[model samples]
Target: MPLLSADQLTIQRGDRALLRDFDLRLAAGELLHLRGANGIGKTSLLETLAGLRRPAAGQCRLADEAAGLHWLGHRNGLNLQLSAIDNLRFWCGINGASPAGIDAALAGVELPARARRRACRSLSAGQKRRSALARLLLQPRPVWLLDEPLDGLDAGGLALFAALTQAHLAQGGAVLMTSHQTLPAPLAARELIL
Candidate 1:
């Protein structure tokens, strides 16, 4: 079964209707890559699917009973004043996820111990991006909604994201993402143009 589906979806911003009558699905072990020009509602589509925004015309559905989902927006959703560890801990407390994976997730993103201890505002762009990506690992959601997920990554960060996403797919999870960069060589993705 498909992990997520959208039918007759319409997205708008203020007076502009950016997309209309769009339909898409993301199945388990698959990735749907959203593509469009700037200001073309890619992020809006993702937000609607992630339940952060309301679609103008249609609805989004999840086949899973648990509503398992992770949303990574274009912004690195981290607390600038908080340390990486602290931000992750906050996410854990809110999501009822165990803190055990915090360290491992940080390591998986190649965030050094020193970087983890510093406030997010002090970290480099790549580090901040990795910190946000770590949230995916901190919680085991079955579906991921990612917007501009590759914005600030270095080669290593990109590699880590590809590996982690592939692992998620292998485990029967699904992804819906927007990226301007090409995905890593081994990860296959279906393109959805706006």
Candidate 2:
């Protein structure tokens, strides 16, 4: 059975149709890459799948009993005042996941040393993005809805993120990420352009 499916999905923002008759089906361990020009409703689709935005018409179904989802948007979604670890802990706790093991999560993104320190209000754009990604990992969701997840990462960071995503998929997790950069060579993914 498909892990998740969106049937005839439609979304609108103030009478502007962001997406119309959009359909998607995700199987276990599947990754669907969304590629589209700006203003094409990729983010709107992700938001709808994540249950953060209601679709104007359509139905989304989660097949698995233990199903859950995570969403990362264009914004880093981080608090400037909290340290990376603290921010991760907050998200994990709210999501019913482990809150105290964020050090390892930060390490996965090559930000271990920055874990204890407050999110640099003065940090570079890349560091802030990494901090937000660290929080994403701390939550244990089976589905990931990522919008431009590769933005701001350097070469090595990009490789690390790809590897992490691959590992996630290998473990029966599904990913729906939007990216301008090409995916890693071996993930067996498909891109759907809106």
Best by lDDT: 1
lDDT of 2 by residue, 1-194 (tens): 77789999999988999988988898878889899898888888888888889999998887764757778898888877887777777778777888666787787788748445866575666777788878657766778889988788887778777788888888888888898788766666887987
- Where model 2 places Cα greater than 4 Å from the true spot, the runs are 114-116
TM-score of each: 0.96, 0.91
Which pairs of residues collide in model 1? none
**lDDT of all the models against the reference?**
0.90, 0.80
- Which consecutive 10 residues in model 1 have the weakest lDDT in total? 59-68
| Count of backbone collisions in candidate 2 | 0
Residues forming the 10-long window of minimal summed lDDT in candidate 2: 114-123
What does the lDDT read for residue 32 in candidate 2?
A: 92
Give a tens-digit lDDT track for model 1, residues 85-178. 9999999999899999999999988899999989999998889999999999887889999988888888888888899999999999999999
Residue 178 displacement in candidate 1 (angstroms): 0.7
Candidate RMSDs in order:
1.1, 1.8
